[model samples]
Target chain A: MATSAKSTDISKTDFGKSPINARLSAEQKLKLLTDMVRIRCFENESVRQYSAGKMGGFLHVYNGQEAIATGCASLMGDDDHMITAYRNHGHALGVGMNMNECMAELFGKATGCSKGKGGSMHFFAPDKNYWGGHGIVGGQTPLGLGLAYALKYKGVKGAAMCFMGDGAVNQGCLYESLNMASLFNLPVIYIIENNGYSMGTSLERSSAFKSCLAERAAGFNMEWAQCAGTDIYEVRASVQVAMERAHNESRPTMLEIDTYRYYGHSTADAKHNVVGGYREREEIDFYKKNHDPINVFKAKLIAEGVLTEEQFDTLEEGIKAEAAQSAVFADESPYPEVSSITEDVYYEVDRQTEAGRTGKHFFND
Target chain B: MALIEYRDALNQAFDEELARDENVVLMGEEVAQYDGAYKVTKGLWKKWGDKRVMDTPISEAAFIGMGIGASMLGIRPVMELMFWSFATVAWDQIINNAAQVRYMSGGLINCPIVIRGPANGGTNVGATHSHTHENFLANVPGLKVVCPATAYDAKGLMKTAIRDNDPVMFMENTLLYGEKWEVPEEEYLIPLGKADVKREGTDITLIAHGRAALTALRAAEILAAEHNISAEVIDLRSIRPLDEEAILASVRKTHRAVLIEENKPFCGVGAQISSILMEKCFDDLDAPVLRISSIDAPAIYSPELERKQLPRPLDIVAKVLSIC
Candidate 1:
């Protein structure tokens, strides 16, 4: 099992020094970089739009933790699934959700993915096998297990990657999910994106763990690993091992990817990132300057002679233009009409079955 | 038609639906090898095997949420909560994930899961175990709540709830589980949001659900025999879709209304129905709408007190005479 090599406590490992798994073609490597750039640029533009009062609701952008979603999604098969907490822009884009629809959703437009019904924290695309951007902390944990349960129930050799933040580590339901996943031997990988902070509170102050968070999986007799989230290669290597365990053995794995986020909890809380803030300015800069996933990967690709600086610049420029184009699309899209407020509440309401047609489902009607 | 206990009627619904659909699965504590706590899922595990009828740990939130997750991917999961009162632990999963998923997804997803268990207070199970959540569940916009008072309604609604393309909260009564009533052996589905007139009269409309509907029916008989007042009993099989037209039609004809429920007096199902009657048929009513809810208190541990705490036939009769 690759669990021995991949499941070490690598929270203190150097981001750029992790052993690289050079199995991807130059095109695939470039695609990973392109996806991350698009996610970063899309969220960057979303913050600007939020500042201009063009968006509504809490906006949790995925700025620094790009490698986790991009790397895990790189290994997803057709039967594989993904679900994450509210900070899910990276995962959504990683699974090939359209930038236009995602951005329009931020603008609360009719053309958005959820038709503007779900605001910033509730993005969903079942067609893409992306379950949702669930708002509740640790609430999606069991759902992730359920998705994997469905896979095993249907005899499909696929895994569900359920992602949550460090703050969710202490939620009772997460522990309940851990026990069920192990007892049922379900094919699920519970991915903990440890960004050090859960909202304004640090992990040290929030969770009471013995060693690291993922080590708690030992209580459930499940496999666990920790990796540097800044290194996409390491992220992919660790998640690949868990996916193999799920596909071959139909087992569950708990992964703690040690990552850092550049912004506050949400764009609404950016004001708390000052010098004397809940976290320090230097801590943020240290990660951005040394461990930025994009920069570290760009340097690695250059060292491998797979990407030239000029080609990299062109790819980035194209990505920037696409992100900007999405903003323009969102700005031009119309808001959903008031009549559509009652539209998607129930499946039968839309299907108009005899039961759905029999009574007044909506009190407003 | 044949006489069967409410539990067996439910068992028949599970048996027929499992035979009818390959995707329908039943999972909960003791549902499999243990034959279910209340035996509602009796013999299902042996019939369908482990893949279909499975046993989960005593974790309500985890299993319930897991069922919701599986239902999203085309599996019709029938999650059995030992008691609807235990749903408090998994309340977020029911109200947030299962209920709101389809709406939040803009119809991109469907959570066709049924979380069913007994939710009554007269069993002397104490305050924590005894709870009627139909009122609480019906308040949510994206959920459908069903309460069956008779074996026929239990069989028919359980079938329809299984086939529904939305999340359904099915509430049963433990005291009514062993009670026998005639139910058709043939396959049939009772549409939700439609009220059943258990007894028809012209003087007053008695609106109730689940066990309270049975109480209202008994009260209707007494009102006819002793008081010489003809009362119509409306059993609200489904709470949310609410059969408001039938309620309005009955109230418009009867001219007086008395709503009864096993839920608490504050914010009960009767509260909403009373407001609906006042707003829609105020001119047609000869008197103000009345409500006979469980005494505004917790479920007592003593059997006698607990029996009186829930809505009784006398409570319905007394409330009816107040308006008559």
Candidate 2:
């Protein structure tokens, strides 16, 4: 069942020497590493709890592609926004959402980010400009276009970061979004996290393209760039350029970040029957050895004398403990009351307006 | 009070709401510069300019989805669809994204956007162009559907829909766009989910919404004059937050009931009304609840046949007579 993973040397530049990395304070650089570690620790714990039957529905863990979300979110201004598909735990954590609330959401407790209504796939934090963890494939593309449209409407010099997987590139709505993003000159970046395989379909099988996925951006006459997601510095540099275009010129950009996922598309693909049958273990090991985002960044930080080995271990341990405590918080939190089931369907009902008082809004009620 | 065309009433509502709320914006194909395909958005573009009143590409899914995204951040986007039949292309945005955003986010977000356009038949636009999806939209628990039969209700209901915190699917009729009725110059808001009794009667209850409500009113007059049957006509302006109380109150007094709608017979709005009557007003009913709807088929393309396809005044009269 082993399908050979192709070895493509994407980017081998030493980010320790890059100006973008040098510009960032040592504390800020450590914060980025700490954020990536926090996400990984949380995702690993989610998979553990999910396997142990603590979570329901599909659990789409963002294990390996942590640097893309971490890098892109760092460049976001207060007016900027972020939205992503169901593989959203990484982005939600990167945007500084409470780990306990996010974990409680996965556990379907009242304290969850979405109040147990939107399990893992619908995290939302509008106060922090994290729009959602939308469920549908390619559906979030247009919604992302909208976030940018609204920003422009309000005359904010900010952009919206809309992240999707490689497989989502083929959806018709993405093309529709691309056309409008260019026509209106909205400040939105469409980041495609190309992880070699989508669910079970490899990039070679799922998409038809001339050279790369971002090349399709040429059809709309928008700017595009490709980068390796293993190095956070490279991710920041490539995304900073897109952010500048969005802020200064009010233009959209398509970014293709080459990454890999160690887990299956979701926890349900456990047998690896879907993914393992398509991709080999050697391929997975190759990425883990050569291009693990956390390891790659940690080594660069140490080589630059930003942190000692002891400091790195202590930081990782603290994040791991924080991720573990989130599970305990989720376990202790209560489920929503039965009477609360009918609430939140409408805003008027929640606000108890004059309109909400009269009608038989709920048929069962 | 001033008599205004249905289209003008909607225009006045848009103008007033746009002026009232700076957060409110209008976007859709041909909405700006072109003054709207149906002219429901006429003159707004010249007033609000590019930022507030804008035109979008012919892509329904993208624009509609964009409206939803904008609404989540407190932008009240009153999106026009040119024709409600075109909403099928953006069905995911309407049904899943718009309707379910607030509920799925557990009330963390509110999509207070109004998607307005024509949804009707009898103009011989064929099956594709002629679609009435009020029943489909109302079926979803999170969505609110309203169909205003009169110019007064069009303006009142539309203004309220724009202010409401949930997604509202405002269904309009091309055939009734030019029809004139009294709408006051003063600002007013018609609370949704409240039905208006177009006529009072003692024998039978006739219920309908949108353009079909007018048809039911005509049938009520026919039944009163010709057949000597007093039929109370109930116009259920809001479909989702249904006015079951009004329906029950009218049916209890009349002792017989007849539901009517422009949608197909199977699982139409009329079907829902009949079910409500059966469950809530069974003891008061003197006969089985009957329904008169557009013939159970796709909308006909032929002009002559299309008229026959939709429920006429005589059709409602016949159904009332059968039940009474």
Candidate 3:
């Protein structure tokens, strides 16, 4: 959707000349671009496979919000944990999950990240400290608090990043976690990707605050900031500072990354019927042409002489090839054996005791 | 062996388990500074400090969900709910998340959390506060429901539930928390899915768990003294992975069977037990399996009405007489 000519311009300063220049190295800049393009490409492939009926369940695409995930995830290390909502393809890709595994998971194959047990909504990589892509709206909010609590209890130098959408913002679980997070000062960051519409409800209709989502954070005595997600630098600047404060001070921050999802909420919702026509294609195209997060980053990289048009073209082609390989790998992967139907219901990896195996399988085992 | 109250047995389990596993943390409202709403936590908070025995706000959904998350990461968390009825607020987390996460993850992760609190009536807490969730939670797969009627069983099974790798719904009755019983001083662990034959008899088998087990025991004594009926009493410690073998064995010995529970009658635990007996021991039974449960209604504030709401020993005695 093209924005009206009178619409306000947000953060037009080139990242190379702004405060981001001092904080970000050239490698980091290239990494951000690569991550964003990789996610965008992967999601595009998902739409293709889904249309072909290669995947069975719902398909939620995170096409336009690439910068929010790529920029924010770059700040954390191995010890950090992440839990996000179900529109999770981009987040999973950003946190360094194998492209093949993530795609295979959607394919319901054994090689998937969650072993095909969790389709679109549930993606877990415990080894990578990416806890899950939970199906419940705001279910991960409290769980992430517990993860952060564990980090603090162990005196580890790590924080937990919990991501949700504007739709999940109003859940009682979020409010409850916020109050508790403030009470104990747990090292956690609650990121709300305010993509304007949650399913079919717009932010203005959903939020009682009726202004900014971050303003609600003040009630919990939590530190919150609002930053545009269109430019990678803007997201990085906000998330880096938030992560630093949470890790060092044992504080919790509620960060609202203002972004937009160009696609409908899921493949189930038709693009033409986006939020019952509240969002026009012109307004959406306006951002894609003028402030598309990925294109904006690509333009910046070219302007800085980091990459020429020819080099960018080669990068795009390479990324497309990589994304295509993931789809093929997912298609070829095997489904888990039938024995796994009842396995993993409890304590699969950790065996607590063998003192008495009597009736163990019937109950605990 | 030393005589101890049901509350002390649970406290000792918390004390020993916390010492046994550093990852075994205790969290709930008033569980730390306030030493638990019912004082089941007691002085363990002082001994273990805030890290292990921590307190939380009156947020059941958040803390219960936290237990699910932490347990998935090797942290054994025994979360206490102020009351079992409060679990309704966090029902989504318990049924949808904790119970299904392991099955859904296909063995990637499992929630080893124990949601324990008082789930009994007759304290005059009225309708909203009381719940006998044995039948309710037992209905869900991927969850182990433990209802220990005695202090000895409470201590042994509390330790077992804490150490087990699966999510367990530990149901404790506040009415029996103060009852005195001889619990062994030595360390012990009672495996789940096993039931105890509290009394051996000949004429009829009485099946019950938690508070109703005590009621059945009393009813057995009354039946023995008043009538010539030698009633056998079976204490089903864990209702989910139920001791069906023991139940069938008992029913075979005693031709008649009677199931008892404090929950309402419609679609309750007895309804399932009766159906099971009909399938397994239909020919062995001399008469149809009868059940005695609380009247089908919500608990009322009035003492007389509450009394009528729950099952009394006389109800069991009459059922045994009727079957005979």
CA error at residue B213 for candidate 3, angstroms: 0.7
Q: How far is candidate 2 from the true structure (C-alpha RMSD, Å)?
A: 1.8
User: Over the stretch B179-282, how does candidate 3's per-residue lDDT look in tens digits?
Assistant: 99999989999878788999999999999999899999999999999897899999988887677788899999998999999888888888988888888899
Native-referenced Cα lDDT, model 1: 0.90
CA lDDT of each prediction against the hidden true structure? 0.90, 0.89, 0.84
In terms of TM-score, how similar is model 3 to the real structure? 0.94
Tens digit of lDDT per residue, candidate 3, span A1-365? 31211112667565445464456777778888999999988999988999999998898889889998888778779778888888988888888987898899999998888778889888777777887788889988888888888787778878889999989988998888999889988898999988878787676677766347776889999998877788888787788777788779999999888787878888987753445576777767766786688898888888777767787778888998999999999999999888766556556323434422333334222
- Complex DockQ, candidate 1: 0.85
Q: Candidate 2 at B233: error in angstroms? A: 0.7
Which model, 1 or 3, shows the larger lDDT?
1
lDDT of candidate 1 over A1-365, digit per residue (tens): 11121222334554334334565788888899888898899999899889999998899999999999999888899999999999988999999998999999999999999999998888898888999999999999999999999999899999999999998988899989999999999999999998888898887678777668899999999999877788888898889889999999999999998888888899878544696678877777877887898998888889888888999999989988998899999999999999999989989998897777977798753
Model number 2 iRMSD: 1.0
**Where is model 1 more than 4 Å wrong at Cα?**
A1-20, A270-272
Pairs with steric clashes in candidate 1: none
Tens-digit lDDT string for candidate 2 (B1-68) = 78899999999999999889998999999999999998888898998899889999999999999999
Off by over 4 Å in 3: A1-8, A12-25, A271-276, A348-365
